[model samples]
Target chain A: MKIILKNICKSYNGRKVIDNLSYEFTPDKPVVIEGGSGIGKTTLLRIIMGLEKPDSGEVVFEGVSHEAVRFAPVFQNTRLIDKLDAPANVRLAAREISGDAVRAALIALIPKEELGKKVRDLSGGTQRRVEIVRAVLAPSDVIIMDEPLTGLDEGNARRAVAYIKENMEGRILITSSHSDLFEAFCETLLLK
Target chain B: MQTLSLSAALCRVTTSITWADSLKNGTARKILIIVFWLLLWQGASALVHNSILLAGPYESLLALCSLAVTSKFWLSILFTFLKITLGFVLGLITGILCACLSYRFKLFREFITPPISVIKSIPVASFVIIVIIWAGASSLATVISALVVFPMIYHNMLSGLEATGSSLIEMGRLFRFRFIDKARYIYFPQVLSHLHSAVLISSGMAFKSGIAAEVIGRPLQSIGNGLYLSKISLATADLFAWTFCAVILAYLFEKAVSLILKRLSAA
Candidate 1:
């Protein structure tokens, strides 16, 4: 599938974060958006994910319809429900996937002991991993991540990226990060 | 082998933490405090000496025992209990529904806010009289209870729904979660956390207002009627006995509602 962003513009309080930004995304080619803080990397991702409307212009998917594109997002922050356990958090988004499959996927990334603990009780890195597990386990045509590896140590970040690459075959992976590690696997989209 | 020991250790730690929390505010201490208050009341009543002015604890207890064996007492208690509970449940449901509607529509929220504010400020006695005039005596308690409880629950619901983290809501939206899933996994917990305190405050208010309405309206075969008759006959012991029953009923209802809400949130 080919997804195109055409002249997309977004501004907040008279400051333009996204100024006529355009990009093309393909299923086989992973896109990594790199920018400093407040340069609208997350905002651009939100525009693509349809969580926010661009001030002008459009997001067009040539080969695929809008409804056909299911997004599994690892938000910039670990947005897991604090009241729910790690496995339950994953299972919430992965509704179409079998419970056993989701549980197995979560148990693989997170420790067996931690799966039953509330996400709020987990450490920052552990919680980030759980969010990754949620995204990976979800049934999605596009995996949208905004700074997906923000809280993780170098080793865990590498492992998380590996899990993403291994599990996300045939799925469009659009991730934004300040880290250069994603540059190895993903085509770069730099924003000023 | 290592995992087993770690799991056991976690269990022991959590158990100890729970034990500590309970000990800090234990039920035994609560009972002792209640006993102390009752003893003070008993002493005060004995010093008064006049039964018309103050009934001793023993006299009140005897009056309660006599009422217990009588069908009239049970009937009146059941009548008032059912009416107030019905009103409470109705108020709870309506408040939640209104809150959700208001949350979704800004215009509706604006439209409803002023009236709800007025309801909140209005005196309970005024509501009881107004409701008695509008709906008559039998439905006065139900109407008054519902009126008393609605604004409180509605206010709490609004704050609870508002308190739901925007970040989690964004996650739900991006995931395209079904309405039921969003409600279950996100909204329910957020709303319920605030709901715990709201239920505690409103349940007590509901009982107090409901009984007050009944007492004024003189609902047939109700606790309020019993209290009225005791006052007229100068039966101080019976008045105290009936008041005790009202307090016990209100206390039990609050406990049951709070317990149910806690269990639901846990589930």
Candidate 2:
């Protein structure tokens, strides 16, 4: 399956964020949207994920109905249920994943003690990791991550990237980051 | 020898002072405060020298004990308690459903505004009279209590739903979460916090209004009827005792509801 953005344009308050952009995202290759701040990387990701509409143009999903396409996203904010623990947060989106699997995934990036603690009580880096795990485990045709490693240190960022790559499972992965962290594994789409 | 004895005496004094300090700061302090108020009430009653006009705490307790042994007293309590609780539960369910509808649809919200406003503006006495006429005296307390509770729960729950984080909701949508998952994870915690305060406030209001309705409607075998009878017969102690019973019941019910809500949030 493939997603094609044809002449997509979006603007806010008369300022164009994404203008006349076109791209094809295929499952065969992972894509990393790299750009400086305010370059519309997040906006483009949202458009592709169907969270936001383009001002003029369309996103054509080939080999699947639009309704049949499922997305798992790591938002700019951690966007976790604050009252729920790390494993519970993942299970909210990935209910089919077993409890043991959730705990195993979480223990890679966070301490075992932190597993039962509410996501709100975890540190920023730990919360980001929880978000990553949630997206990775969720059953989706496409995974869209907006700065998934924003709060992580270099070691954890590398670990998160490696985890995400291992679990791609033949699904298309579209991520936006200001750094060149995913350049080694993902085809860079530098948004102008 | 003089110095040793002086040091021992100083230590004893310090220990005694510490004990006194702890008493003033603990549950002992609360007991003392209640005793103080009871004494003041007793003194005032003594000065009045009229048991009919002002029943002392002792007389009120005596009245309660006497009523407690009677089957009619228990029956009246059960009648009022069941009716008011039913009304509250009905109001709670209706309010939650309405709030959910209002939150999801702008048209429903607009449609509900005038009725909620009317309910909010009208007096409880007026509703009791209207309910008595429409549904008869037997159902008056239940209807009135529901009328009183509905608007409070509706308004508060609506506010809670409105205050929910939209970003999280959007994330839920992106993840293709089912309605139950969205409600359980995204809406429930937010609404539960607001619902807690609403329950505490509305539970007391429900009991007060429910009893007032029974008193006006003269419902058979109700606590409100018991209060009315005591008043008409100049049984001031009995009246005070009934009032005490109502307050205690309201307090217990509120605590129970709070506990259930706390458990729901935990789960």
- lDDT, candidate 1, B1-267, per-residue tens: 999999999999998887777657986567778889889888998899888899988899999999999999999999899999989988898899899999899999999999999988999889888887787899887888888889889989989999998888888977778899899888988899888898888899989989888888898889999899899999999999999999999999999998898789778
- What TM-score does candidate 1 get on C-alpha atoms? 0.86
lDDT of 1 by residue, A24-140 (tens): 998899999998899999899988988889999999988889877889998887788888898778778887778788778776666788877888899998998989988888888
Off by over 4 Å in 2: A107-116, B1-19
Q: For all candidates in order, state the fraction of native interface contacts they contain.
A: 0.82, 0.91
Tens digit of per-residue lDDT, candidate 2, span B149-238: 999999999999999998999999888788998998899889998999998889999999999989999898999999999989999999
Best model number under lDDT: 2
Query: What TM-score against the true fold does each predicted structure earn?
Result: 0.86, 0.91
**lDDT per residue, candidate 2, A73-119, as tens digits?**
99987798888899988998898999999999989878899998988
- Candidate 1, DockQ to 2 decimals? 0.54
lDDT of 1 at B129: 82
